[model samples]
Target: MLIRLAIRDVVLIEALDLDFSAGLGALTGETGAGKSILLDSLGLALGARADSGLVRHGADRAVVTASFDVSEDSVVTGLLADNGLEGEPGEPLIVRRIVKADGGSRASINDQPVSAALLRELGTRLVEIHGQHDDRGLLNARGHRALLDAFGRFDTGPIATTHARWRAAEAALEAARADIETAERDREWLDHAVAELRQLAPEAGEEETLAADRAAMQKGARLAEDLGHVTTHLDGSDGALAGLRQAARRLDRIAHEHEALATALAALDRAVIEASEAEDALAEAGRAMAFEPERLDAIETRLFDLRGIARKHRVQPDQLAALAEELEARLSRIEAGGAGLAALERAVAAARTDYEREAAALSDARAGAALRLDKAVAGELAPLKLDAARFRTAIERLPEAQWGADGRDRVEFLISTNPGAPFAPLVKIASGGELSRFILALKVALAEAAGARTMIFDEIDRGVGGAVASAIGDRLARLSTKAQLLVVTHSPQVAARADRQLLIAKSHDGTVTRTGVRLLDEGERREEIARMLSGAEVTDEARAQAGKLLAA
Candidate 1:
């Protein structure tokens, strides 16, 4: 429930701090008594859009702050936690909004800065403002389904779970269809590529190995002619090694005839040995240089084919093997397309059946809920002076193809204000006075189910009089049994119903005008109620009526 409201420099309200209480409280004053200004300030603190003109004439900015005391598990607390604001269980949440004269605004919750949009989102969960022109409470189409469920005390868990199942099935079906379409589109290319790769029989690292062998063979071929010429010269019949051996044999035959000749024969034998070693080395070189052109040609051909295949596939040679394997798998799936598609279709059909069954159940539940809600709201209308008004929970079927997260039903609150009057939307058919009463009836019906600790009614008595005003006040007081209510009103009867009474008055000083609110005592409340009933005069009869009202 809203615990406090503080306002500064907002239009006629220069500075004001008002503490609120649980149960039905009323704010009453004459016209132009700054009652509207007070509510407007509360609205600002609740994240309503700010206007530069709202700032006081001499002030640079305007500020509004509201404090709410909510339970630990309240939706407002969850919202604050979601936005990283601070709040403890059963603690008061302070939401402050500041609007500068330059058309800029700031918002915060529990002293932590937050965006105005976030603050507004949190505010909606905490407080609902119902007025003549206010389409928020039960009149909003967005909340009609929720209101219906609440009124009927229907459990929505099953419906939500069913909706989730339906969406999941839909998502899976879509994904499968996309996959099938893409595979079908690429079927021809995949088949051809797979066949080509199978024919090529590419292997990882084959290109590098083959290229290295081809290069070695080509180098050998380039040096083959030079090696052959050197071999011929080294092994010819009159080559140095053969000639040296012949000379060594002749020197050995004459070595005993002369010592010097024997020494020369020894040196010639060493030279022949060195020449023979040289000849052996040349023969080994000749064998190594004998290049096999056929082997070289084979290596070149393999290398060219590998490189060509890599280029055709737009991949490096090393990636060709992996790419081919992937293509083969894709082609295999395409070849078995009939079987694959049939299996997917069966899965999709089964999922759809499950989803449809759940959705149908949810639809039935909602229909039942709507019936009960219609009766409940109708029962609440007579006392609120809406005897001729009709309340409806209208549900229409959405196309199965257009089903969404909320399922296939569009729910709206439809109403007919008079007999034989065609039922139109509640917001369109109900007059300002009628809308306020309708909202009150619905709130009284669903207050317990909504679990809202507080319900604030801003001038809900607008355009009402006499018994109708008393009826409104009586219902408000009754509503306080379940939850707190704060009403800003001009009706003396409405003021008379409060467990507490507050008066908002504007007073001007020599330099500035200020707005302030005071909680009235029993005597003061009587005078205030008299002021509301008799306008400028406080008559004895009005006070007598006020006394009777208080006694009642």
Candidate 2:
């Protein structure tokens, strides 16, 4: 509920701070007493359109601030989080709007800077303002469905889930159709590529192995002479191993003659053994480097085929296998299009059936709820001097294109002000005075269901008096039981019903004027009501009537 409002340099308002409480509060004043200015100030804080002319004549700017207290689990908390704004759940939501003399505006919430658009978005969660020309409340057609659904206590979640599944089915069918279309466009290329890849049967690691083998085979032919030269030093005709072997034989024969001779003979034998081993290694290497043109040709052919195919596909040699697999899969899907399409179509049909069932149920629930709502609102009219007015909840089926998860129904509150009158929309059919009373009837009907913590009506008792005015007051008081209600009224009967009353008045200091509000005490309230009852003069009879009204 709105907790406080402050205004500065706004038209006739100089500096004002009004603290509000939860209940049926009334603001009463004579004409030109700045009551409208007070509401305008509140509207500015709620992100209404700014006007430079609203600023005081000698002031640089005008400012209005409104604060509200809401529950921790309210949608407001989620909205704040979604917008990246920090909020403490226990603290009041303070929204401030400042209008510059040059026709500019700035907005803030909880002293943190915000855009005016954002402030307005938050305002809808906290306060609902209804006037003759207001459209944001029940008058808006977009909100009618939700409002009706909320009132009916109907859960639309199932419909939403079913709709989501239907949409998913649609997406799948589209994709399958798109795949078929694309495959039709690329049929020839796909067939050729798949056939070539199947024939080649490329392996993931085959490219590197082939390249290495090709390099070894090609380089081995070029290094044949150099390899032979190295072999000659160890195992060829000019190798030193023959001389060492001849020396070892001679030394072994003399080894028995002397100990020193035996040592020398042992060394010669060991050297001969080492020379033979080294010669064997050189001979093995000579075989490894042996030239073979036919083998080299085979390796070159394999490497060239792999590299050429990879380049043709504009892929790395290693990725060729993966590319081949992907193409094979797409081709397989295209071939299976008939069965796949049939399955998708069946799934779409099933999902649509599911959605239709749930949507039908929701539509039935709305029809039932609309009947009850029409009855309830009609019951409220006669007491408010609208006995002949016919209230209706129009539940019409929307076109196929506008069908939604909430069902295919378009719900709107319509009215007929006279007998035999064709029903028209609520906003279009009512006069200024009639609209206010109609708004009052709606408030009485939807206050608890609206989910708005604060409901403000401007002069809802306009052009009403006696028992009709009293009836308006009675309904306003009942609405306050559901939520915080504030009404600006001229009727003494309405003023007498307030849980708290504020008298808006103007005062002058020197040449300057200011608007202010004061909470009326019991005595002051009686006098104020008397003034309302008797016009400018509070006669004894008016005071007695005011006393009786207050007592009642």
Identify the candidate with maximal lDDT.
Answer: 2
- List runs of model 1 lying over 4 Å from the truth: 70-74, 81-92, 109-116, 153-186, 205-300, 451-454, 463-466, 533-535, 539-548
Best by TM-score: 2
Candidate 1: give the clashing pairs: none
* Residue-level error in angstroms, candidate 1, position 546: 3.7
lDDT of 1 by residue, 1-552 (tens): 888888889998877788888889888776777888887888888888888889988899999998988764357666776778867765788999999998899999998888888878787787777887786766778777766666666666665666576566557656756766798898888778888888889899998888877776677789888877766665678666667778888888989999999899989988878778877886776565557889888878887887898898899998899999888777676677668667766766776676677667767888998777778789889877899988877888888776655556788988899999999987887888788888888777676667456677878888878998998998899888878788988898998989999888878788877777889999999998887887788999989988888888
| TM agreement with the true structure for every prediction | 0.79, 0.93
Model 2 CA deviation exceeding 4 Å by range: 236-238, 241-291
For every candidate, C-alpha RMSD to the true structure in Å? 6.5, 2.4
* lDDT of residue 497 for candidate 1: 89
